[model samples]
Target: MKIVAVFNYLLSFLIAYWNTESVAEDEFIYGQFPSYFRWGIGTSSYQVEGAWNLDGKGENIWDNFTHSTPSPIKDGSTGDFACDSYHKYEEDSKLVKSIGVDFYRFSISWSRILPLGTKEKVNQAGIDYYNNLINSLIHHEITPVISIHHWDLPMPLQNKGGWTNEEMIEHFGDFARILYANFGDRVKQWFTFNEAWVICVMGYGDGIFAPGVKEITETPYTCIHTILKAHAQAYRIYDLEFRDEQQGQVGITIDSGWLEPSDPNKLEDIEASERALQFKFGMFASPIVFGKYPDIVRKSVDERSKQEGRSTSRLPSFDKYWTDYIKGSYDFIGLNHYSSYLVTSASSDPGPGWYGDQNAVTFQDPSWPETGSTWLRPVPWGFRKVLNWIKNTFNNPPLIVTENGYSDLPDVGLNDYGRIEYYKGYINNLLKAVIIDGCNVRGYSAWSLMDNFEWASGYTERFGLHWVNFTDPSRERIPKESVKYLRKVFLSNGFPKPTLPWNSIQLNEQCAAVALDPDTSF
Candidate 1:
């Protein structure tokens, strides 16, 4: 018996060694996310499915927005011919399966589905494109999680006042109903909006992203109101008309980044940071979960509205029925987490007051991770903390981590150990949030399956675990070491056993066996 115990111990040590053996400079994150977690990758229409204005598709807001003024995006770049996944999704899916992922989270371009963004006339060609895409995924045994919209509103809608129009609620619902009728059978999951904060602030208020309009007071606030109403309308439509029949869940994707103070002991800085979060993630989450906007947002904005002599709240209010209608519309919360920052109250300076009249404090973390992008720095602990904050604050809503990844400089090399390290750190923190802190995390999809247009930053930031040769006409795909590494993990059912041939396909069998046995814990 003693010898058997000793033998088991020996195997454990061997497994650990093999897993970490010659691992590059990054991979040492500690903690676990959750057991039975789903793993996959992500991409969006404009960024990847670049069939812009192709195949009888009608022009959406992005097409018009980008074409009219391309300078607002980071590199004056547009998604005219992104990764060309619109034509080459088969090749893209091959890369996904090669990594042995079980799911693929992507968005259906509104313009692609309803060229004019209406239910009155469905675009059969657009519908066929997604039908084939969904069918291809299922053929490869991959689950498809679809986002209904990812910030690319149709140009016609904008001309009609876009989110500024209360009628958008019905318009968006019409769109959702059409999506449900066609794709509901195969695509069981859906996200209504990608990130309201960025869509409102960067896209409209700051004129940074597509549909670039700038620094307009009350416009961003009004957009949020219309957006919330639209989300509620679409969600109610799905629940009342399609959920039971289709057997699917629907939700909205909220962009959340952790806020910290440059000096933890400074009361003003801490207050400002918390307020920053309220403005960003809370503006969305609080409404759905707690049945109202963040108290601070309501209070501050009301005063601002009053000071500006607005007769009502800058934050819109729904009738009690609509409040309830919007409050519990989500089945789960889709989160996009990339990094955290330290925000301090603006000290009487003249920067546009974003999160309440505040000060500038650069985003800092003593030992955060870095991606290829200059604006983003990774903070794994921030992820765990953010999850816990959401879990506790929102009464533990089920969660699907829709997008989390490290964007490094393009051509960082095929063996991007930096990315591998980023995954380890974030995934570990995710597990800690789930197991240790009790956040209800169900799945994780890395930011991208393959790098594409990357929006304003253009094609410069590569977030894919698998690299794409954008310059190559064929747009060849190459698996970075992360593809193999994450495959080892997913195949292991968590972390690969530290044993010989750590990257071996045999580990997948072991993982399948363990997953089936129901006795494994990560």
Candidate 2:
């Protein structure tokens, strides 16, 4: 089988790498993760939930984007019937329990809850759907980790300028307040927004995502400023009004990646790497950790804006009120990291928008193995590097790794040996960060539970531990070897005792024998 061979190759590589690397003397014992370390799986509403127009759910920007005359989605597919999870969450909950995860991290659909994106109109059907999901998870003793916004902004808000409009602060706060009032008692961990960088940079700066507007110029900066304020308001509301009563923790999830300088000895390359980081992670994180934009970002954007004939600095400034409110607002740092980039100082403009705005360029090493997705390349060591960077830069903030996974096209079948290697290397590096480097990571959630609509990629790419047959009207779910692999990791609470060369072909055959069945409840 193709999968068996891939597994063997991956194990051989890992064993060789482990033998050569200089490990710390005081490294935490393998497979001895702390008792409280949480393991979970992640999914987003727009990407997974179908019934897009059913149950009075208001149209979100994604709905509009996918339905546009000239759709940008690669496969010309829309998420209108994605997994039908909106109608079959009971089945989803069971899938989570079967995997032995401690929690399920899923986002709330803003348009589903508030059709008008305002408190004046609450959709009872949307409320009912989520309530049923929460109750089911609770019944199974699986904790619910909620993300308040995950890019499915109500079309009404998009029509009115979305994140770019400062008025969004009140809209988001009110929407968050509604969620807290209803579900705060049961849901203890809350993510105010999922991947602020993707929402701003991909959505506004690059025009590749929903409500597509390519303003690689200053709009992304403005969008993130408003988003940060909105996040602060939601966090503060939960902090002041609900934390004592409900005992829940609130924070935001950021999409950050490790950046390796193209030339370690060159100052220009090192600075370029830092600039890339500042433009992405620091754009949102600085407002939370330092209560302002990074100096590099401010300086670069200001200088570039002036040169481009702008009247003032492109980077927006927060008042003392907002700065104070945004600072120190998180209970934990929720990070969603996937691949790392090799960065170098740009000799010329990289492109329009954020690419050019950063004054740097990123490329991937040809030697690194690629996943099904063109963007994802496995570089496990970078995972530890980024984690250490977070530990030092943010003073060892408590962290929940919200998303990480590999993608392969659906035609690959459910063998998914590549995904197994991806998780193993990244998770092993994560353990090194926590144990040897002393980074304060408390949890890890693989990017998704099953393959669903992958945003712009549509149904072309699969990231789920379990594979879903999109062409099947029943939306059948099938277990991949990664599921069995991860379930073992969950049961062990860390790396398995022998550390995974699982060296025997018989062991690979045993893993390959796991069968797939349709979830009955769906």
Candidate 3:
């Protein structure tokens, strides 16, 4: 077994090396993106804004989480001073303007605005801060795309059961109304929620995130149920009350990874791959697009509950009213895609949890290039495939790539050749999806504008085009090599004729070495 593995590894490396050399020599000419297509970069409130509790801002789940004894953050770091964007909006706006992007996508801190997550006690300071930011972006000719919630639930609300409680739908709706009334005039693109799955599954099921609760059977499902309802409520609020006047679009951003079958020839593997996607992406998307959960999700959870001797299904069911209300609630779909996974059918029941319910096991292929983030791999082709899947599944709803970018280790410095290649491959694939595949992708936003607090991982993972000096009080931002590469891509609107050789030598060497190591985890 060892001898065969070594030989296979060597053969794979040689093949990859030959392909890399050939591609570097070939003249690569890419087609132009649509002139109407927009470009932007993104950052969330908790990840970028450092003033966790200041100037009438209340505590959020993240503030509480990081402040807890023996913090769960990998580096024992908190976002209390994360990039200090709260105090440096002017500087940040200048950075965004320098990027030459058409827009900037950012999330409003729920507690910052409402202070207590309610509309009753509005935070004037918070309102002023965002107003200034918006006015600054507009001053710089940059549109502001706002996400109402980005997983930073006010601690006051989390104490009241957060997303697991049905009352959150009303609270979230009220929050949306306040935002629309205040910022909707200037903010034309509003995302009600960012990455509902991560907010629910990772936060509630795995307990690896803030407001942690690890009850997999019902907690995660209940949270997502509330989230979908809250999203719909926010969408409806904007549609009925503010749409005519504000002239803004409302959407929800859902993060999904492309899943491929481990064995193309095996029916079970293919079925498992589809089931995994349905469980992961469709769990949130289906509610808004198809008016209910995916058929497989419903059936699987129903069957699993029965096996557990429960009289009722663990998965929450939406009645006719919700089915109709949630359907067609979005003006567009906000998609955040990063990586791909190979999935196969679990040989046996994997027990009672989210992964168990799907009956699928997902893993990464050794040949795929890795990133500093353990779960992410550079699989550009998967981007196109996932876009096509969305196009087919949702009947080609107008879509925006909300969050897609590469991450590197903290010490990788500013050169960052890997990130440049990543953008090159992924953006090229994105072009193919829009041009050749005919997917209705409207715009794209890189995951971040600068390095800041990365949730549970703290500052260990850097996913920014601009390197931020975390140690400095000012958090000075320096552009990485990828920034220059992306600026050229943005200025040209697409990849122009390659005047220089494609820089794949380093990436090829790294991936080839990774492929040879059988024990590599990520």
Each model's lDDT comes to 0.75, 0.84, 0.86
Compose the digit string of candidate 1's lDDT tens values, residues 302-415: 776687777986667668987887788789999999888877777664432354433345466656655688778877766766776676556789999999988875558776
Residue 112 error for model 3, in Å?
Answer: 0.5
lDDT of 1: 0.75
lDDT of 3 at 431: 82
For model 2, state the Cα shift of residue 303 in Å.
Answer: 1.7
Quote the lDDT for 351 in model 3. 82
Candidate 2 residue spans exceeding 4 A from truth: 1-29, 350-352, 496-522
Query: Which stretches in model 1 have alpha-carbon errors above 4 Å?
Result: 1-35, 349-353, 357-362, 365-369, 496-522
Q: How close is candidate 3 to the true structure, as a TM-score?
A: 0.90
- Judge candidate 3 at residue 384 and give its lDDT: 74
TM-score, every prediction: 0.87, 0.90, 0.90
Instruction: Compare the candidates by lDDT and give the number of the best one.
Output: 3
Ten-residue segment with the worst summed lDDT in candidate 3?
513-522
